[model samples]
Target chain A: MGMCPEHYIDYMHDYLDGDITREHEQELKKHMQSCVSCQKHMHELSDTVAFVKSATHIMAPPHFEANVMGRLPKRKNVLGIQKWLRRHPIIVAAAVFFLLMGATLMASYPNDNQFSVTTQPNLVVDGQTVIVPKGEVVKGDVVVKNGNLIIEGEVDGNVTVINGSYMASTAVVSGQIEEINETFDWLWYKIKKLANDAMALFE
Target chain B: MDALVNKRIKQVLKGDQNAYADIVNLYQHKLYQICYRMLGNKQEAEDIAQEAFIRAYINLHSYDQKRKFSTWIYRIATNLCIDRIRKKKPDYYLDAEVAGTDGLDMYSQIAADEQLPEEAVEQMELQDRIQYEISRLPDKYRSVIVLKYIEELSLQEISEILDMPLGTVKTRIHRGREALRKQLNNL
Candidate 1:
């Protein structure tokens, strides 16, 4: 019988584990008696197992429980909105999708009532008067409807007046000023306003 | 105990915030031991263990009552330990030395009055050597060995806690034992 050291080492582990059959156990025991290296290997393996089994148990530091409890975040109310969203991810996703959809639809839909206005302080409209107040400087487009434009300041942009008039005193206008009083222009404006209001509802 | 833990969990979910303390107290020692064995640093272990409990508390509603609470908590702790290990630079020699001093210092003090000076020192040295070697093991093997030997968990339970197959756990354990044997031989 060829008794290899490596083979014996494997058998030694099985033997220690009590998984070896009687026949194999007998063979291994016989080999151990004749093989010095295998005997040494078995002894070392056994010692290692013993050391691991006998290792000292280290307890957690004192006041470990108190420390942990104190450090714990204040328990959040489980019924909070964040917890509810966590529990119902599908509902959260739906809510997000609807929110984004509404924003996109609102952005794309035309609203004639809502006109883009320049944020420059020079373009000021108070009630029916679009006034470029004295000593003020405007640097963008100005559109006014159903109101008069009073200019006593410097204007550097286009001024459009619909169903209204413009008056300037020592005011510098850098862009064209137009008044839409023709029937065709009035008819076009009304048609465009009606179409926009209808689109706003779908949006 | 499991039934009691489950009941506490139910109370906690139902707005009894104080009930969580029972759960933390029940598992703190075991979780700390696992962290200590894995990190080989008392301070890091405490921090990680405490963090694990806090995370578990926050996510308590997500915890399925059908599952064993111990397994769930252990998984959280083991994951936190692994993340910490990965983020750290590999410093086997430095970590082993620091761990040796910290661990040996405490044990040596305790054993000083009980045993002869020379014998206590020798025993403490041996324990330090074992700890250093254990710390030197690869993360995979170290985790399995700590869970199996120190934590005294069953192979099946370890498998569940680690989210690993039983066969893989066994293989790692076998490899870990072999590595430790080599370290012991050198000693």
Candidate 2:
């Protein structure tokens, strides 16, 4: 005897939420006139709504504005390095990553076009081409700049060619053979080394 | 007033730090009320309200000037309040008795100083009970109820403040009212 039609219950809630259509509201009112259960339910819902609305609003404490003003972080330099860094974390990350990557390119930047090479004890130098003879043993690292390196014998250390090419013919080298042809090649060499080192460490 | 608020925002952007004081004053009471209703403790309400204002000032440049500043500030305040409610350990105390109100209750603290009429006092005690019930609601429903009824915001506004769909907001409001209605019926 006290149950409301399911749709009528929905109507009651929709009315209280201020979302009921005019037609539904009229229908609900008419239904409520002959339905004690719906009337009681509507009264209960409205009472709770009114009760919350009637809650006593408190005043903000005195000096609230002063407190908020005081707490504003020292904005002397609003976009100070540290604050800007904190706000744009992704940009900061990308900036940092690229900066470190650019460091390799900076080191490889050609300051001059000088043809230079570290002499080997048993090496033959022909203009811009440095060659280790067929049976000679180089004592230390061989670096050729603005030139080419031709190794046909044993070199006990690394062979780094800068702004040039290298051809190893029956060469026995104890270290890495790095060919840095240009700025970009140097950057790629350093990046590849870094990535390999990182992977090794993680593994 | 919106024009004035936008002006203050511009001045603050131009290194006028004191211009933010106007914003703080204009919204302090309204924000404090929402904080108070979300968290029934006077001390926490004041602290969160102050924090919201500080955060807003720090991120003032990110605020879209096209929209009402009130909504932006309210969103910040409500988010802070909801975070606080979630951080608190789930309190399952089912008591709504005015006598069972805790020591940190704002109403009990000020009830002594208010020499209100008999009817007013009774009404206040009732409000205290309602506040207790509101605090006991789950965080999801509690925010919707407080924003809708206590803050008297429209459904659209509540949706924006809570960053939920309007349909989700409506569903939460309905469920929250049912919960409150059941509590009143039991009482």
Candidate 3:
């Protein structure tokens, strides 16, 4: 039985699997009789295969699947949204900021156009000025300078007028409507007051 | 097709998060086995296996779709185990003398008994010894041998997983197993 090293090596796996052809098997058997080194190598290969094949499989732990599953993101619907947002963090952040701003503005001023303020008498107020209609009250010492103040009823607060003007009705001025129509501080204050009230509602 | 798996994985990378679970289910068991063999403890193996999967999931975009997904995951798990083994200096605590005498005796007794063929039993015992010897191998050889023999990956697969040329993978497997055989013969 004559065998080349290459053929024997090629057949080594088949020999171990017990699937060698008859002629090659005879050839290998005869070669192994005198080829001590090749025989030892063959034995080693067979032993290695046997050893590996005999390895006891340690089954993964009880929560093996669960542990891996837990590592996976929870199967919530929002994870998809989160993943999408994570992929585009910049865009999502911008969108969320604008969305929150719009919601805040809408909540802060439910109605867009009109604002009203009540006045008190006897104190010299600094800035209370708006375009008041024909019949409105000026109860305190009020001054109107800059803004258009529509003073329809009695002014209970001390009105100090500045740059803006106030169209006030003929009513009682206890102190003075001091400053008006100067900087539109009256309208700014009313808008600011509405914002503060909205914030208070949130709390 | 493997492309289908890669496509699913691409979906996972592209913000289809649920698609990740499918990839996990496909490879977790095989990864667990590798971790178990390398780490040799159930709890640690489980943790390492899960972490390996999660890491792979997070870095899935970096994986080349042309390669087998199994090979990719195996590489990650093996590298992690090797890193842990190195960081912990497994050799110091992994002294053969520290292994339980009872377990070794019981295994030897089984080998010496009549339940199986003498050759088969000796092979089994040698296999256990080989596994122990693997832990004693230097990191580079250790990884290649484990991936080739114990994990039963093809040479191409091992090379791909290791990101090495085929020649290097084959040489490492040969030398690693030879080292194990030498250690076993002495034992």
Candidate 4:
């Protein structure tokens, strides 16, 4: 019985690799003795391997070492803080998160004893008195906490005075006048101010 | 030699910046040859080889001492070459022609008494044919063949460099050789 072409090719590789057993080797030799096609296939595979093996080794061009060395990245000092930060990314991220959190808290924190005041050209602050001068137009709202609001001019918007009194002389007040002396009103004002400051911080 | 290279690596880690030039000199030719054979373009090979060295230097601290330095460097170079091959469109014939012509001119000068001039010419032609055929193989097979025959690396080394199983590398080599044989037969 002769070996089939598939078996012949399989044995051919084993034979070339010296991996065939003695019995298989003898059987393959017997098949090869009569099979011209298997012999040709074997030679072609062997020649292919040999041709690749004999391919010339190409040397790098002149100054190749110099070129590579010049192109090499400069060694960075790992002891630097930037390197340390790179190695500990989680710590860096956590530090940044905490810093932002602290800033937001500071900006949003309510101060029970501090008050802010804004004055237009018509509204003036003189030592302890906030005065809206006569013959001047106040275009926006006027709010005063813990002090007296004196409007002697054209107040075109609302006037709110908290824990304080309001005095007007010929004032053209277009909006309502509010005087807040209750504790609930003070707490509400503080909450609104804190919210406004927080929004400004984000913007 | 590995011990010496390891010593240099340690020196580099210890702030000896110039010590890396020695490592570059040690493997430049081998790395360049592998890239040249794989890409079939001299300029690309040089550029890729230089990039490999730069990458290796940047990542030197991550090198595992258990493996050979040559294996680590070769792995970096081979990976870069494979990425470049995948990213770019195939320009097989253009590179083959340029490299083939250069190979013929270079080999003609060294093809003295060992073989007749006519046989040398035939050998050069065969070399060009093999290179062209190698460029046409699938990326996986081409990588194994170039590392195997051109670099003469052991199968185990190739497996390590490729991060592939030994059996898989063997199969690729077998398939690559078969493909080359079919091409040769066709010619």
Candidate 5:
């Protein structure tokens, strides 16, 4: 359980960590030849160190970046967010960004609907038609998919639609209104969303 | 390189979220490896690694410009790992999969050297046993052992990462290695 000559323990460890000087190493080698206990201790400790150093170098999982970026929390301030705003191509092309989001459908319906709309609490829903009925003041984020989004009322938050038409007859919006009909717009939407978010810092 | 990393940190602090991505990409593997060795679970390691980066991002204002960003981030991750290890009951995550099916193994090493299959499997088992023993180490000893042998970091760098005196680091490494040898002896 212990080195026979207790100080030899330091010699063994320094030797194992390769932190020993040539002089000390020679002394350690010379001592180990005649000292069975220290020799056995050194051998066992070397095995442990070697075994540890042999561990495999594990890489981050395949979706590491997406997981980090997708989970990057949103900030309420724009200037606090814009420095990263244009990092798109100057940063990343965000090509994969659009592709991964292709599966997010209606938050409430959970893919039951063809439209990938976010959940916008309060409003009107009739079959595939969703409406911010005129005069009705809807709060928080809203998304529409599969069916058309008719905005005749006032929305206090952002409105976004995916794979569906958006008709704003008399809609008064306080935030960004994003309508995505193509994957290309997804890229544009990303930038515009940042810009829109960036603008909030100034306001 | 550190100057560039600091600049990127400044950029991120100024409102560029994308700038942080570069930092994440650069250190993800290293941090992930540290977390994996420390926590012994791929899922928990990934979560802690990501948490470290996000925490750094949110607290960029407090980062000391004079410090090496790697050291700073490593400290953050090391602290997170210590917190995680100390919070859990002993051996709670012991069976959370110590084998790195995704990466290297000693069997492969022995096979590469053209050793016999029986010897390779035996060595592989020994290696696996060593990893599990490391994961089972007390938080203090495990930290020093992982930083020294697993990461091959300098004793000084490990001191900076763990924020302890150099002598304490050496003592822990000695004790940690001793503990590992004892555990492996039972095999």
Candidate 6:
């Protein structure tokens, strides 16, 4: 029902390749009866196909056989057991069953988790004016090198500043803070870092 | 015969190494032709063809006996060619005159080369033109043209080689051939 007139392009293609089925050949002929542009296209396509087919005749290289022989793997001798298993249906079935069972068991088992950890160098604040915001926690190790740091929140870890002024405010601390001017023990350091970081935030 | 080929392959898998040489010898020429035509370089074609054989042998155990051996090997060759073609950028340089019949008008230069026989030289040149045009075609069509015309494989055989429906193979070959013809006409 949806059949439109077949184009000369299709006929040309089929004629060039000789792949046209009997039905299509008739359709092509019917279309060619009235269409001249496609017929010209078909003629050109056919001539072109003929021209190319006549021109190119590349041959394989001389050493093809030797090269192939060189690359082949040395055959391994077949063992009696492998041969026996190859022919034994029951053994093959059992082997397949066991292999699947082992795979299924492995898949069903939950794996134990081991702790994975990574450590980064402490944050360094240089002498440049650095601002720390209020009400934030500074956790883990932070190193400031030669910079001004303002902290106003909580620090749950270490804070080290080198040649840098640290502003601290009311904040919780669980770890130590060290600066060129002063060193605080773990609890004091944590509180100082947090306060400084929080204050720095506003500045 | 298909089963027999499969049995022979199985035998090769079972360490009958000599059986492999038989398979190679049987398929080598046809595979070589496909590769050579696809690559347009003899040395590369030889290498690709040989590799196809080696791969076929190594994977012999996985081969299904239901399919014809020729179809399987042809697939390998076609794939190898496609890989080679894909590695290159899309544009391919073509011999313009040979590609178009209009260039045949310039046959005067050929008449001057004394050492060449007239018919032989013309045939060689024409072959080169055809090959160039074929190579310039898109891979989908180029493969169909090569399989149908140069290899002279049936549409059914091409379908098997490509693992496509017979109707699809026929349509593609037709379309591809037409494209080649168009390209050549412009040449």
Interface RMSD, all candidates in order, equals 1.7, 1.0, 3.5, 1.4, 1.3, 2.3
Give me the candidate number with maximum TM-score. Answer: 2
Residue B168 error for model 5, in Å? 0.5
Collision pairs in model 4: none
Q: How far is candidate 3 from the true structure (C-alpha RMSD, Å)?
A: 12.1
- Once fitted onto the true fold, the runs of candidate 2 whose alpha carbons sit more than 4 angstroms away are A76-78, A81-203, B90-124
Which parts of model 6 have CA positions greater than 4 angstroms off?
A1-6, A12-35, A55-59, A77-203, B1-7, B90-124
Candidate 2: residue B108 Cα off by (Å): 13
Candidate 6's displacement at residue B156, Å, is: 1.9
lDDT by residue (tens digit), candidate 6, A74-116:
7654444665776798989998986775565545332332211
C-alpha-based local distance difference test score of model 2: 0.82
Pairs with backbone N, CA or C atoms under 3 Å apart (clashes), candidate 2: none
- Root mean square deviation (Cα) for candidate 4: 12.0
**For residue A72, what is the lDDT in candidate 4?**
64
Give one digit per residue, the lDDT tens place, for model 3 in A1-203. 13456677546545653557998888888988888877887787767656655676556666666666666754465755766787898999899986776566546432323333334342233344343333455443444333345455566545654444455556444544544332244445445657878999999
lDDT of 5 by residue, B1-187 (tens): 8888988988887778899888888889999989988887788899999999888877787899998899999999999988887775553343344376655444342212122344444566655655566776777899899888878899999999999998889889999999888866755
Error of 6 at B31 (Å): 0.3
Chain A only TM-scores, each candidate in turn: 0.41, 0.47, 0.32, 0.42, 0.39, 0.32
Q: Summarize candidate 2's per-residue lDDT along B1-187 as a digit string, tens digits.
A: 9999999999997778999988888899999988988887888899999999999988888899998889899999999998887765444332233455654444344313223344544565666766766876777888899888877889999888888999999989888888888866764
Which runs in model 3 stand beyond 4 Å of their true positions? A1-33, A73-203, B1-4, B14-16, B90-130
TM-score (2 decimals) of chain A in model 1? 0.41
What tier of docking accuracy does candidate 2 attain? medium
- By DockQ, the candidates rank as 2, 4, 1, 5, 6, 3
TM-score of 3: 0.52
**Per-residue lDDT of A4-118 in model 4, one digit per residue for the tens?**
6577676776675456788888888898888887777778989988988888878889888888777766555544566679789999999998677556655643435345456
Compare candidates 2 and 5 on lDDT and give the better one. Answer: 2
